[model samples]
Target: MPPSGPPTRPPTDDAGARADAYATAPLLNCLLREVAQPLDGTDEPRVYRLPSGERLLRVRGVRRPARPEVSVDGDWRPVGHAELVKLVAEELQAHTGLSNPELPAEMTDSRDAVAALLTARDGATSPEDPYRRSEQSLLTGHPYHPAPKARGGGPVARWLPYAPEAYAAFPLALLGVREDAVAEEGDVSALDAFGTAPPGYRLLPAHPWQLDLVGPGLTEAFADGRLIRLGTTTSDTWPTAAIRTLYAPEHDLFVKFSLDVRITNDVRRLWRHDLLSLRRTDSVVAAAAAALRTPGAWLSDRGYRTADFAFEELAVLVRDGLHDHLVPGATPLLAAALVEDFDGTLPAGLRDPDAWWTAYLGAVVPPALELFARSGVVVEAHLQNCVIAVDAAGTPVQALFRDAEGVKLLPEVSRAAGWERLVYCLVVNHLVEIAEALRESHPGLDPWPAVRGVFAHESHRLDLPEAAALLSAPTLPGKTNLLLRWTGANGADARYLPLWNPLAG
Candidate 1:
């Protein structure tokens, strides 16, 4: 891994183009999936009709749709991101017969945030290590999310310092919790190495952004000496794609904090209920990982600590780092980054796409299925949670999963529900994105055959009946993020729509 210098800023002319590209992708995704219906016999410039308002829309590309236009007054008019947001709002209001003042504002905030991120990224220095660079490179996140880049509608100054997209790394605020007021579970001993607390206190590292957000609420705790600020960490930790999680390179550890700001559907607080059940959830996944026949590993969420007074506001989770879980010589990269084309490190000149796709499916798929079938644990094997360790040749060799907070156990959810969730995460969300990237890069290559082959092979090994059904299923469940957010549904409440299954011949 070589040291990276600051990225050169693009000219003003190019900056706007880049920002539009970033902002419009998710908006178009939301529009196409939720409100617009594709027109028949369209290929070159894909066209759609917004059935609700009888408006015709057209765009150039597929994966990240661009050059949007809508037919108006007997002429096609180009819709900028702002106009697109407005169109989406109007269409949704008419289609659902429901009005939301907040979502439209969030749509604008998301666009503005993209523009700000573009400005910050210009002349910004990226992390030197490939893994760190991959983790920090997600500027246009959650391709199908309407407000993926929205930062709680905060001013740039408030959030930029902690933004992973800005290539940020900062020290955590170290706090001393009075021993009597410390609420902790499992192995939080790793925190003690950062700094020593006074005789009657325990060390608890806090994300500065979170502290800033909740500072006003904690005046009395600070005044009464239940919580003592012990200054910042001596070294800086890099913010990963999930902004709330920080990676301390020196310690090779990850710390997840409670953030009050909304990152997608949720306000990202480390809720007390989730924290209370963390140990049990993690133990189940860890045990399943330990029994894996392949090199797949689960980066365990070992423990967490927080002040009893503000448990959810101040809770911090300790997760095992990549170093220990990775195979002897493999370099780990965020799986989501591989799909996003970060650093363009994916190898070129591969004579066989089948081999590559097979290797990827081999590493990513079986573990999730095996865990579900054998251990009754449904790992959230989505791309962001999965870190694929690749060899020097950029071939995926192993898969490591994290985020115990998202894992669900058998009997908690019905077996049918568990299987549905697993297929959606593994096939729809994770593999489909990667497959599209591969197909886009290698235009002549059909990736589904390889995917189908892997499923057929794995079906014999795993006891999952859905594996067989998945092969010929006409549709798969696609999480309706746009509609879910628009309807103001609970973040955990998942509502899915049927998506055409590519695996079906």
Candidate 2:
């Protein structure tokens, strides 16, 4: 076990205030983007006209808008998180002429979850390693989603122990599956080293939280002797930004499990179909990474293991760790953490904003485009799936992409559809967020020109005609998460609305 430390509690009032700030930004982002219109010709406090056009709203910050107020009786009255949920529900109903009772509860659950995480983090000690610190630092997640932090309305006690935001690390629950009932594909040999199993069984490591969620359902298997508990791993595994995936520093490996709770859009389970098709998708991405001219890597999802009786519920995937793929002496940082802000992740001080911006684009952009154009593999290069390795001087040296389950093949999807998805994931979701973050820090810097230059330069070398067209396109597609949630659409069903393209000049 890892060494333990004494717990210290931050004041309740301070924790609540921090939670409110973190929760409000994402809610306000949804309202402003999907339902509210900017009320032009205003100064100081920015104002917005609601969908009804009768009510007006105003907020205080630029990047993270706060202190929301609604106009009533010609006076502005502050709205709390509860009132904000109510207001969003009413506005969505008015705009779409459809109502969803579940989303409001989810919005409230998200805020309450944040409050719980803040309180837990007060008594917790952060990981000493910079990479682990970056992985766990997301307080307000998914800037555009309505309930990015919601954990399926589970009790705080049930989920808080595993939350990445609270700096959590715990040993994985090791189980022994009867040899006859074991189901596995590809290379899952890495799992065997975690713990020992009996002669007639194979070793299977499960996420403690996931096991907790599915424990009752597995009682029959345990009773019948098909599954046996084999204690926990000797070393501690820390949760990454994606909560279900845990990293064991000692082994230099990642183990992904089927988390039952809803995060962002979907119930984060390793669905049976995705697991069955994992090897093919991973192989294509691996091939693409090998062919890239730039220094980039792909962390392959090598294999998974589960019991035949509870395949989807008990499944766990093995992924490559950062050690082997990383450049010598380079430190790997989660790309999302770079945008969200974490200690020691960003450069000490960026002397030249333009050069810094160029380095970032150079490391992140080419690989995705190259994969799409050359190998017909569309890697999900979103912020969460990408890791940017920086040298000692804090310059981005290489880009590493992961999550094979999210990769799409060109022949599988129509060319036009694949291109759109690639553009959305790489440009709109990844680059736009990073650029805005850079602009927020360096107010005088205009990062878009460097972005335009990178795409233009790449267009001449790559065969993608879409790259040239993207340069002059009027708008880019932005995923409609707010509407998707409200309408109860499949999480993977991406529907986009036209967003003004910054690349278009």
Candidate 3:
């Protein structure tokens, strides 16, 4: 005290004491010297430029709040740095046969070292439940009210053009009867079918659009607790049309028919009426097959078969667990049911316009670039074809793509649909929808930084660096020109008037 010019006193509370300790604690900087470099490949700080033009970096020091909004006494609050180190130490000992009972005290105590271990673990392990349904159990079952889908068994029903015109069309085939002894209908609800499938078939939930076209069949199926219907599918928004859910009673199997036909004239026009456009959906099926072939995919299906669907080839998959199954991928995201209007009233995390931009550019955009490079095809990976499943940790895991019809393989790249519709669908519609959802959920969250994180995280998986270049690219503020905004545009900047879809309105 006598020697010092000023007096410094530490706070009495535990929080203040902890903070003070953190400031002076010696850190090995292992993250800088070892982990971050190998993971990131460069010394460049993980800095991202915000759309507002400010540069932001990862929240340094202190780290994300240690406390969640709510916590229970027994909950395994995110494995702390010390605990994480212990876990890593155990894993290393098991893998390397290095009996390291203790992670050198220097490493064990380092928070950065723990973080690096977590990062490496993330890269190495593919978590089982990608959709994070375990956290939000509310979304585990049907988003809508459960419908009893069991119906009285009978001969195969006729394929009516419209629900109202049911009597005109002749039966496509016997309801439970099959010409071949191999094919038989099962006694199970539509939900049961989705959970399990027969040896030569797959059952998937029909898209909302497909449900609307078939009118009450889907709702009725849901109500009856068991019934399957077939009809042509509709648009890029949903692809449930012409999809069928067939069950086999004797084999206790469920089969869903997948088609390559577009149900709408709009989608047909968008792709110039080429069957190659169907490749998007086809590619998804193909990718799943390829992924399954790799032991790493960890898929349960025994195998898949290619069958004819309206003159085009559609894939039929057979897997166990029709009644008791866990998709781990589809269950969670669909539960949230993103609200689709621009009321400017979405959540704080999603409301920020910048957040939307970042997600599209960072996470969604790079994959398109990678796909273009690998297959020579730029796919239209819009919302309809893509299923974004979030995990218990609230991280988006796998982006499951379905409905191969929207896919386009270029002639030069393979000549298909060129870049017109592909660009419009992937870049415009799909990206915009995700952006809108993000903006609505986290209004205050910055979009660009999120996108950067996505790009940084995902791009590291690909072989090509060029695909990641777009992460730093700027995005134009999006403007819609539906009929609602039309008259307003004439009052000011006439060029920007139409803001609403006239037909939809």
The number of the candidate with the highest lDDT is 2
> Model 2, which residues run further than 4 Å from truth?
1-13, 344-348
Please identify which of the two predictions, 2 or 3, would achieve the higher TM-score against the true structure. Answer: 2
Sorting all predicted structures by TM-score, with the top scorer first, yields 1, 2, 3
In candidate 1, stretches whose alpha carbon ends up further than 4 angstroms from where it belongs are 1-9, 347-352
Q: Put down candidate 3 lDDT per residue, 1-505, tens digits, no spaces.
A: 0011111123333432242222112121112111111224323323222122221212122211122111133232333345433433443344344554322232332233222222332233222331211211111111110110101111112121211101111112211111122211222232322344344333433323223333443354334433333332221111121123232333333333332222111111112233333333444435543433111111123333321221112223333322232235323332122322211222222333463354335434554645554545445465434434433333443444433433455453433233434444554446544554464455554444554565455456655453254444343222222111212232112121112221111
The TM-score between candidate 1 and the true structure equals 0.97
lDDT of 1 by residue, 163-205 (tens): 9988899999999999999999999899998888999999999
Over the full model, what C-alpha lDDT does candidate 3 score relative to the true structure? 0.30
Tens-digit lDDT string for candidate 2 (1-505): 1112223554645877677788889889878877788877988689999987778999997767899999966899998888888988888888899999999989888888998988887767777677787788788888888998999998898988898988989999999999999999989999999999999999999999999999999999999999999999999999999999999898899989999988989999999999999998998789889889988899989999999999999999999999999989888888888777666325324777678779989998988888888988888899888988888777888899999999999899988899999999999889998888888788888889889988888888896788989999999988889989998999999999888899996
Task: Select the stronger candidate by lDDT from 1 and 3.
Answer: 1
Q: What's the lDDT for residue 229 in model 3?
A: 38
Q: Backbone clash tally for model 3?
A: 72
Query: Candidate 3: which stretches are off by over 4 Å?
Result: 1-331, 339-367, 412-420, 449-505
Q: Candidates' TM-scores?
A: 0.97, 0.96, 0.35
Minimum summed lDDT over a 10-residue window in model 3 is located at 143-152
Query: Which pairs clash (backbone N, Cα, C closer than 3 Å) in model 1?
Result: none
